[model samples]
Target: MGEENLAAVLHAAEDLRLEKWPLPEPKENEVLVRMARVGICGSDVHFLKHGRIGDFVVKKPMVIGHESSGVVVRCGKAVTSLKPGDKVALEPGVPCRHCSYCKEGIYNVCPKVSFFACPPTSGTMARYFCHPEDFCFKLPDNVSLEEGALLEPLAVGVHSCRRGGVGLGSKVLVIGAGPIGLVTLLTAKAMGAATVILTDVVEQRLEVAKKIGADGTLLTGKLNEEEIVKQIWNLFGGDGPDVALDCSGTEPGQRLAFLAPKPRGVAVMVGVGPPEIKAPLLSACLREVDIKTIFRYCNDYPAALAMLASGKVNVKQLITHNYKLEEALQAFQTARSGVGNPIKIMVHCSQ
Candidate 1:
């Protein structure tokens, strides 16, 4: 409860430091949280290594994590939803309610949103932080603090599955076995997809996918677009999948997702990729395949929490490594090198 608390700041590219800083106070509608765990997302690593992610450049020193959970230590006067000792997951983005996007129920795309770890917003890679009480969803007793932190990414998976229209007897193909990809696979399976095929370049990741209940795993190493298409078709018995999701964001992965769907099937691009991508659009146009894109997530936290609380999704298997706040540099290094079979690396802020 002291004023000084530890925080991980990205001072410069590949230069992360853990230092003592003043704990922030909550505003009238905010709550002060004692951070429990913070998940190291790919965006975090990108910012640590390059000091920027696309247009959001770190012109000033910024805290490093967004997918996180914490215990509420203090609540503002107007905060009636949460109180002290409540364990909750921070949604990370706060959008202006007056905006058209917010009014239209798509706050994730709000232009006036202030998201954690993005440009000017300081993130939750610290001992204590403050956020809007509404953005903090209380976790049930069955869900651990670590699982609370994972809800952020799991929300994305839920959104992707919803967009892809996954349901009973749905045959789903998930490209990429990274954190988001694995989460998507789990979400699709939980939504009643009979078959889920996961593809990744790393054998270890694919192995993890299988362990996590993926019906099949494919290793696509330097395979051309045609070869990848053939492999996917063969996996689905030469009929193509009911739904294909591109969670890798690579050109090849996106192309494969677009081409792996049967006529009238859906292809959802859930991965983050370059602005301009080259693909075979004519094939998709002729097949009448529907294309959809996801941006973060919307109205998915409640579903993610319900799934976790009900044991419908096993997210614990995705956490492969853990480190203290002081070991942030090593965590970033390990994530960047990809030398080990790391799936989701967590930074323990409370430790």
Candidate 2:
């Protein structure tokens, strides 16, 4: 028999199965990689629980993971920068360079892009996969495959901060202490935010946020919207944060993120949320508070990989659970149950 690949296939909502699939070969400009680690992203969980994210539906069985890192097993004839035995992080989305967005260097939203685990396109939750060589970035010696996988989300933090203009002496307010929020806090500080206040409904997540880099933690459970606004200003000495980043995506959270920013301050919506949202947009506009949104990330992986390698960002501490790829269903269950106070669940595939 020819070589086969083991994949974690999601057939329907909460219906994931382990199956032997065909191993892929590299194209002239592609490289075949043996996936070593895949981090479970929020969108992965959303797709499994709902079978779709807006218009992207899973009409066919698909392997379901995008945040991944692997070792190069083989390289195509045209791929010279990467060779056998190179460890690299896969940039899940491949854009057509001919598109206008790609030409503008904003290919993350290129309409024709094929993003892994997003539907029709298969993903890297398998023993082996083939991807374009240019999209697979080599990892530094100090970075682990797991850390390499995290660059995907860190890129989001980087993109969001860049859009919000987070920099030197900035006072930032981050809503939601989930993985994304924590990452934003770290990125803000790394970019020189002098003070950061983080809010979350979960105490444990707040604790983890503190351990990472948050200057202040606010448990948002008991506070009303106005109270949250009051408390946030009070935390920063009765002044609003210079920039507010909303990572919660909840209605109240989004509204509060915009409200917490100083007049003329910048606020961003980074997390994916319900299709429709109601917030104080008119009020924000009158105050000249700039409200922006973050799609996926683009052109930030190189910096993110550098940050991970130089110890500027420590994603290792964010991982709370680890399981072999064979136990992927169990890992998904743990993530969905919200039990074990799991911050991040990782699936090791190479073993």
Candidate 3:
């Protein structure tokens, strides 16, 4: 192993430097991974551009990626389930098992959780990195590295759907045709949602949603939020969706998620929007709709990997761009620009 690893480090907003960071050693319960693929998530771009996501701020130089898959190059003595050479999809958050949340299996909300790319914790945008062994899921031979890297977003969708109670015969409304929204759409379909309606301001994104089989697509332009909600209701044949997921993290989209669901339905807030949201809680209360929210994810990595292995969900086709790790700055530029109809931009580190 090299003494130093190449990594994309974010020093401040819009400041990313490719520097040689010292190679990390595996802890007793960790495994050393030679990263193969790393996907640039919206949060990653947000951190690069704005230097923070809600309360998590980039106080110092931090490695800037989390959606990752890699080959196990070494394992600590205490790592029993996996050995060297295992291809794995990394679940980036490691919570304190002693915490009450972790004890209850909702560790995603652990107050002391250490998550990649979330300030103070270095991430996997490097040639090599080390993570807790249990958090690294072995990938099946049929699941490509690219697909493995995609599981992070897919897991978010899975967790959101689980929270929203998306199931057979459920009608779903997904507000946002971004990567997360698209994954939510795919998951809703896989979970047997009878009808799925998706909305986005971007026609290109809506086109992707349509190609991926959203039953209805709403292009929100010039229309007021109420008007858009009316159209969304009309799209569902005026019966309202059984579950509405707000993946856009905007106030309007979240308001749509709150108002577009049926009585006693579920509305999931999946994206991180402004710190203080102004959604109508009383309106949802009047309708008796359940409002659910999720953090990153919890106990979903295995299920997501299974979906990929079984071909239940297709993530390979969602990748719209790729770049070597060295081209990370330009890649971030492209991701931020929102040009080229880019859906998922991935950065590769190794074979």
Report the Cα RMSD per candidate: 1.1, 1.2, 1.2
lDDT of 1 by residue, 167-202 (tens): 999999999999999999999999999999999988
Question: Could you tell me which 10 consecutive residues in candidate 2 have the lowest summed lDDT?
Answer: 1-10
Global local distance difference test of model 1: 0.91
Model 2 / residue 322 / CA error / Å: 0.4
Clashing pairs in 3: none
Model 3 C-alpha lDDT per residue in residues 1-351, reported as the tens digit of each score = 744699999999988999998888899999999999999999999898899877789899999999999999999999999999899999989999998899999999899999999989999999999999889999989999999999999999999999999999999999999999999999999888999999988888999999988998989977887898788888889878999999999988888889889899999999887777788889899999999988888998887888889998999889999999889988999999988978999999886
Q: Name model 2 segments beyond 4 Å from true.
A: 1-3
- Provide the lowest-lDDT 10-residue window in model 3: 272-281
lDDT (CA) for every model shown?
0.91, 0.90, 0.91
Candidate 2 structure, TM-score to reference: 0.98
Q: Count the backbone clashes (under 3 Å) in each candidate.
A: 0, 0, 0
